[model samples]
Target: MTMSITELEQALRALRLSGMSATMQARALQVAQHQMDFLEAFSWLVQDELDRRRSRLLDRRFTLSGLRERKDLKDFDWTYNARLPKREVLALGTLQFLDAKEDLLMIGPPGTGKSHCAKALALLAVQRGYTVLYREAHQLIEDLAEAR
Candidate 1:
């Protein structure tokens, strides 16, 4: 037997597919408007669910990262930071270093945007599905020493 829309929505919710459940009604209209076939409509629903899950996972990672502040690469003041390696700094956003087992250390005197860059990269790593435990260098060393 075919399931009614309400039953289908309930089943989706029970399965924790809230994204599909919430968007199914609106997506159904899109399917009709676009004259989509069954497979096309189903694909749309699945894509929406996947995108929503990715967004939610990113948010959760950001929360768990314990970052003092949220920062974006685009928000950095490029104009004022002319001497800074803009290309190199922005390249960190690609997050290739983690894959290569590279650790980034930004050393500079205080007030040279060190904290800003560190926090921003940490945010990128978390958003890119990497588990990050953000801790100050001093704090991490202290913890390690105490553990020993």
Candidate 2:
């Protein structure tokens, strides 16, 4: 039996597949226009669901992280600090340290973009599905004292 688009969407929502439900009308249109076959449409719906879940997960992670600012390593000024090695700093974004279970420490004088790099790396970690807590040195000390 053929189901209406609304009925199919309701059924998908009931199955807890909101992602597929959301794109159902569009995919149906594509199918009706013969732009996509049934199997191809099914694949697109599944991919849409996966993408939605991944986006939601990233949003959740970002919310849980105490990051006040969204930073990207690419936004960093390589010319700001002549002593800072650009290649080495960019490599940290690879996040291999997370897999190896290692901690990162950045040390430098003021105006050296230490905080910027740290925050950017933390953002990267969050995007990669890792839990992150970001704090300045003073704030970190305060949190530690409060916990004691």
Candidate 3:
């Protein structure tokens, strides 16, 4: 049945007079009327909106661990590789650089998986929910010149 404002006020008064606990008083308010139910539903909708916004901001701030696919890092043999020291340090540095919104440079001989490593790292950054852009160094410069 519909509950008028006056009825709601009476219920509230009764609840207070009866010394109902705060939790019970809140539940009583929720059950006061169909309108109260609508209000509660609207509040939940707003809360969901806020939560989504917060999640987006967090995603922008840090790479989410979920973004790194195992396949991406699979080809690299971490063991028995003489270059392990450099690549390992670079990987750790890449994570820190991503967090700080910094740049990374990978210079090495051809056929050394430079592009593959770059793509894997970029993908990792993407998994972390960070905004990422990737391009060959020459192509990026070309684009910049064209834009200018």
- Each prediction's total of clashing residue pairs, residues at least 3 apart in sequence or on different chains, is 0, 0, 3
Tens digits of per-residue lDDT for model 1, 1-148: 8998999899999999988998898878877798887788889899989999999998888888879689887788777656778889988888899999899888877766777888899998887779988887788899899999
State the RMSD for candidate 2: 1.5
Point to the candidate with the largest lDDT. Answer: 2
What is residue 103's positional error in candidate 2, in angstroms? Answer: 1.0
**TM-score for each predicted model, relative to the true structure:** 0.81, 0.90, 0.45
Q: Tens digits of per-residue lDDT for model 3 on 1-148?
A: 9877566557745754222222334444565655467557546545554565566665654343333333356666556346646557456535888778677888877766666667777766665666666777887899899999
Q: lDDT per prediction?
A: 0.86, 0.91, 0.59
Candidate 3 whole-model C-alpha lDDT, 0 to 1: 0.59
Mark the regions of model 2 whose C-alpha exceeds 4 Å error after superposition: none
* Candidate 3 wrong stretches, greater than 4 Å: 1-71, 77-81, 84-90
| Rank by lDDT (best first) | 2, 1, 3
Per-model root-mean-square deviation over C-alphas: 2.4, 1.5, 12.3
Q: What is the lDDT of candidate 2?
A: 0.91
Q: Best candidate, TM-score-wise?
A: 2
